[model samples]
Target: MKQPLLTTDFLDRAVDLFADDVGIVAEDGTEYTYGEVGDRVNRLSNALRERGVEKGDRVALLSKNSHYFIETLYATTQLGALFVPLNFRLQPEEYDYLVGDSDPDVFITDAEHAGTVTHLQDEGGVDEWICYDADDAEAGQWDDYEAVLEAASPDQPERPDISEDDDATILYTSGTTGDPKGVVHTHRTQHYHAMVHAHHVEFEDDDVLLWTSPMFHINGWGHIYGLTGIGGKHVIVRDFDPQTVFERIVEHDVSFLGGAPTVLNFLLEHNEEHDVETTGANPVRVETAASPPPKRTIRRTEDELGWRIIHAYGATETGPLITTSNSPRRIQDGDKYDIVNKPGFATINTEVRVVDEDGNDVPCDDETKGEVIARGNQILDRYWNKPEATEEAFTDRVEGWFHTGDIATMDANKMLTIVDRKKDVIISGGENISSIEVQDVLYDHPDVRLAAVIGVPHEKWGETPKALVVPHDGADLTEEEIIEFTRDRLAHYKCPTSVEFREDLPQTSTGKIQKFELREDYWNDDEDRRVN
Candidate 1:
């Protein structure tokens, strides 16, 4: 690790470093230089300050991937306010829970989500909100963000005296126990993650980054700073559509992008009429972690899309980028297919170990699987407002180690393959489904005596949640009614797609539901690494 350079004003320094370079390009063709971005961000910061946004204040942002989202995040940082990015995909009630918990000062949103934000505001107690496209009639009551920026000063404020330990961002992560927990990170920690990513992923100054993933996701795998740290250009996408992604990739000559397995799956399956030129070495390189990419998806990207797909793993609490499956260079000679299939070694700044239940390290023999744990500079500072959870997170007999709760194995050469989430595994589309979350929704059901949800293979949406229910004594419950009940009570993805009536469920001596035993039959023939 190199000696630390600048402590704060990372965006300002990056702006000067890449002044002449294109900093951002919108889908509608608006472009701005790095210098311009810095100026606007500074002005926006001053404007926010005038509007009562103070140091350490939480400012929420609910918008798609666009220049405005970037502007608000950088600007909020300037004022020393924590940027709380809201997932647009989350249900309105979920957002309500988050807002009530975090109590952000102002929510910077776009016209598309104005109605949702308005609804939240009416439920009231929220501080304030500003909309990026308020001039549109659909925006209704929110103040104009553009108007605010125009009235504010472009001069950068004196960098506030912030310690390395001061919170910079509050990223929310869904927990199996409750709504979601805010994973807090400091400036130093986020900088460290970006530094690690830049060195390991090799994001260059000239590279153009296409915003395929939502910015709400761990700051889009830390590309917010990782790419900016190296002076990379950003090409914004308002929403992720297959044709839109391909068009932006070619139109901007995108060299880098990140997404989940679902994003890649959509791109591969898209049979649109656009003439895509994917021959020769692909300009696009993708990093995926939302879910592990299937071997077929990996091969298609490499063979047809000309992409260099890298599988990286991390959680919102880990500053996101922890491990990357760097495609082996030797694959070009022979068995290119096999080399790309392996999830590569631990990341540059991460020290990973596969450990048994007894907390001893497992062998690097590939076949012996254990829980994966990591210690890194990018670990979250704590779970906000929850001291017990924070204490528990940092707790372990091993000093400074954070338990990831993922089961994996390492090869002789240190390549890792993730097997399962310790508690949940679902089998759908011939894929293992980890119901770390479905259990939460099931437990909330009123009539359910005992509910254990698993995944049965599905032709689409990969894995579908299937619940095995033990109803109250002599109670007759139909699968359709249960499915309908869950559909109204939980997120569509979390709802059970199928139901199995059972008199009893398999349980351990200590009374833990044995999900492994329950999933064995559904995943018996699957070749994918996760099912095992």
Candidate 2:
């Protein structure tokens, strides 16, 4: 009665019970049932084995949101191989660095990025190359993805004896500071996250999830596992097009999905041009992470769009679901804006705390800020190859809790509100100011579309808060007007001293604004760049 928990159990359950149900609807409008998808996973596993990918070998994939990505995840894990999903937006040199670091045995990519891999095949250190949507003539040493699947038998391969502690995947962080670190997760850790997510979001077998977020980002925040485990249908879109997303929700009857606040903003903007009913008998529920949406955006999303919004907070090391704002009663009785604004309570079986510099619990007076730390079965065990980084991440200020490097405050109800990244906090005239607080005020402006706040080198104050804003499509917003707008709401020190208009802000693949990039030009002349 003591069977080990494994990720393969999710696919096995779906195959055994929901085989006849539609499991995936690709962007090409082709549908595949659970039974058919299961066959493909088996065939892919067999093909990898034939290619000499043994247990513990790293199988890396670089592709967009597609059915092939899902198959690769199950196939790689089924054979007890560690899956490494790479960000497609990275440069060739960045890809070279990751491939070199992870030491993947097989590197797989789609046609759009085949050239990048082909150029790196000489020095990428990968043993095998697999290309999807590649012509046989163009694929030199690379194996065609479809051809390999076509040649392999559909029989399920013999799975290796995998333990719950076995490494299931190595997800690379965004590398805001320097080179990306590989955050390794065990089968049990991921399984726990999937179970918690399924329970928190109340995912049912009838739920249809749209793939708005890339599958590469924490396995689309674990929906690839959590949603699939429930035998829910997945509608895969190649990319996030506001109009296309609205169309898919209606076309596939999508019940749930996840994205960042930026994606939600895009959908809201799209609705201004076209009419789309997001709420009805089956109102679409969206799970948003990254930065918390401004209170105005949250209210508009629910009242105007009619879609329920769930806010969550976590990092790559925390299985990406440490806390979620998912209380039905709170949303029903309390102010919806206030409830959804907070990151909500710690997830089931997870412990989240805000600790001071000495590792003591911060007062839950709702105004005191401290470093957010988490400990649970779902937290990552270590970095892949960096022992020093691994040690520092876990034992820096606390013994067991993973230091999240985020500053947050917990309310009396235990709802957590993130203030800012520890490194992004602006210090002006010896006073600390949260960049998120300033950006939230800027987001309230009717002319602003997306905004980022960074601390720039100042002669007198040492460092001052500067704002970079992207205005609405047709709004001709002036810097003086934008500065006055924020000055009216927030404290004078927290308001931006200057404002710069841009067409768009630099963002990571997950829709997080890269503040470091915004600060680069401003702090270039200074030898000692004050990140704080």
Candidate 3:
């Protein structure tokens, strides 16, 4: 009656119920069945234990998406070691900072980041190095990942008496705002989050999921748990390539995948050029987040790509999935877009509220905007080793609710539509303008490929909206044309006062536009600049 919940339950389920089923398709075309993967996971766990990695030790992984990456996740957690996934896109300096901060007992990575790993071990004092793709000589000092597994016994290690609240993983935030904060999630939190995620996404054993989102980002938005829990197959990709994604989906018969709006745009453009076939008996379900895609893009995903789009919203701290736009079947097709466009209701076992500055819930009139706050079993309890940051995240105004720092509005149906990030809101001449609103308008322009709205310092208005536009190939769109385009669609004050054209916008590893990076130059000396 009082059994502790753990993420390993998903792994156990997969091994027990779907032993012969193909569990993962690696980027290099290697396939691992559930039973084989489970054996490898046990061997990896035993190897870590043999190397003196004990419970509560942090084991850092810095690699692209692969079978090795997923196997390491299960193995590290099974031994009750805290899994710390490093963003592979980070520089050596960033790696040093993360490795130093986490103080992992063992560091596992691939050949691609061997240089970074070498730097970290030399400079950051990383205790042990395990290289998955290294040759015997290349891995002379470090442990070869395969060799360690080969030498270790395949028997499953005795289960540690792990508590539900025991730390399972430490996922560092994207560091878009500041130095990355390590968001720690317990086994219970991950398990509950996965269960709710599986429920909302309708994951089934027959479903073949694609790894569009990076495994480093909130554990691929909990798919590593949710899909695995349902015994679904995962098609892993090292990076998001439009053509590669298309091929994998068709090849694996991928039922679902998740990504940011930018990823969807790339796929759409790829389809236009190559006409990648997505039509099949199983329509691939595309879950988009990080910023809501324009309704037009969502419609095109369904009409052109023959995929159903599910929009959801959350951050790394909220088990990365608090709200989803899974609509009822009875809703008319015409009204479905509206449902999918909104972030929709809180997932089961989660409470999501839009609150005013004073922490009181805003009216669900669909007009009043407020900061979104969430509290759930899956929500993180604290930032690892950062008490001040943890305190700041959970305000005294709301006891349990974690301040999401996202500005949003809720409809009468409790459907939440994100207006903008709290800092991304353009406050011009005392009026709060949602940057998302301006960007949504800019997206309507046929020539615009990608658009990002930032609050640029203005002498008159404190800060005025500025638009960064990436035009379609061969399209010569003028700055004036973009400004006038938004001016006609939005309020003059809400429209961008100036526009800047770029071949592309600065983005995080997860494909989210780094608006703060864009804002730094404009607001460098401005005292009104908000830093989170």
Candidate 4:
């Protein structure tokens, strides 16, 4: 008599109970009711089925924030196919490995990024190519998305009988030292995570969500499922301009939006400059994650904008919403900013622990910094096609628990305050830039002999990657040249903001570089730890 937990259940309930309600607002301000959204999903699913997408097949999407992201997610998962959403900011070359690794049969993208993967489609990795606004697309032989949907039958697709444990999505996360690894989540994992996250944020049917966060980022922090299931409205924002965000919040009466601390900083700047209205008919609450914001940022966002801030912590491997600072009872006990500033205890039915190098629990005096570990239904099932990497992740510090590689301190109340990154991954502006990845790129420079990358404090972004290099003898490598080299090869955001010339990099006798020592100059002191 038990019902299976499925990701499609969210959309199914929306169409069944809230068909007449507006479910999504497109990037261009067009509204789509749940009925229309369901019709489009059915058409897309049928079209993909006709074109050879089947159970266990992968359907990849490359786009920014849009209604089509939600459509594609349900369409693919409903048919027992795996949904793969790529980071749209990635370069053409950067996608080569992701495409090769995922090996999707169908690839979809927006007109802006259609041409980026033209060569990938031609190489036979993908069987079908569909692009939104195909008339303006630069890629050849791509079919229009609307045309494909119109040609297919607008009926419920014949779904293959699937189980909860079946793989549902593949999200790629940056590996500190090598190629990006795919984090795979099953239907039950996403479904349960959405439910737990919905309760933590206290989502209601009448709530309105502004899609400020990119939909590709952990499925917009899993709001695409939680908000939709609760019969809330989604207002899309394709390009996150500060002015546009404030306007949308005022116009749509947006009750909730996910903005990292860096994004909140931008909004604070714009609000101060223009003196714009921050909210509409509804009180606004923003969910911030990625890297923890500085105390100054939290104070300004609350004092100036007058919006409630819910800070969270987790990686793409975790549910990305496993921990949140949104305790109503605790707010009455202490100052509001002090309570919401740190990532509070784990969500309902989730277990989080801070463990020492020996896998023992650290004293929760808010002083002992240890690696964060978690276990929950929301965690990723496995890393796609990388069994060794998956095993290492779960067994590195504690056996059977997912080692998060994030260094944090827990309070007496089990609240977690992140201090640094153990793996050297730089979380700048809500995007994970692998310090090793940048170092690898720097090593390719002919003038560079020894290279290291570390996150340094930034006024705008939470922090940014900075490169330190020891040039070869008599090789005059300027800072501009080092920065320009990475810009040409990597995404501009992933490039180093500044470079430093050094005579030698501190290394152990075993030739391993000590980045923590190099980070001391950029970071203030022991009290001011690196908030990766």
TM per prediction: 0.78, 0.97, 0.97, 0.82
Candidate 1, TM-score vs. the true structure? Answer: 0.78
Candidate 4, 112-217: lDDT as tens digits? 9988888786688689999999999865788999999999987998899989999999998753346889999999999999999998888999999998888887
Residue 112 in candidate 1, Cα distance off native in Å: 0.7
Off by over 4 Å in 2: 136-140, 277-281, 526-532
Whole-model lDDT values for every prediction: 0.73, 0.88, 0.86, 0.86
Q: Comparing 1 and 4 by TM-score, which wins?
A: 4
RMSD to true structure for each model, in Å: 10.9, 1.5, 1.7, 10.7
> Candidate 3's error at 255, in angstroms?
0.9
Candidate 2 RMSD to the correct structure: 1.5
Encode model 2's per-residue lDDT on 123-151: one tens digit a residue.
64677888887774354567889888999
Q: List, residue by residue over 269-369, the lDDT tens digit for candidate 3.
A: 88998987875457788888878788778888889998888888899999989998987762464387778888888999799999998889999998899
Q: In candidate 2, list every pair of residues with a backbone clash.
A: none
Candidate 1 residue runs with Cα over 4 Å from true position? 1-9, 137-140, 271-275, 279-282, 327-335, 396-399, 426-532
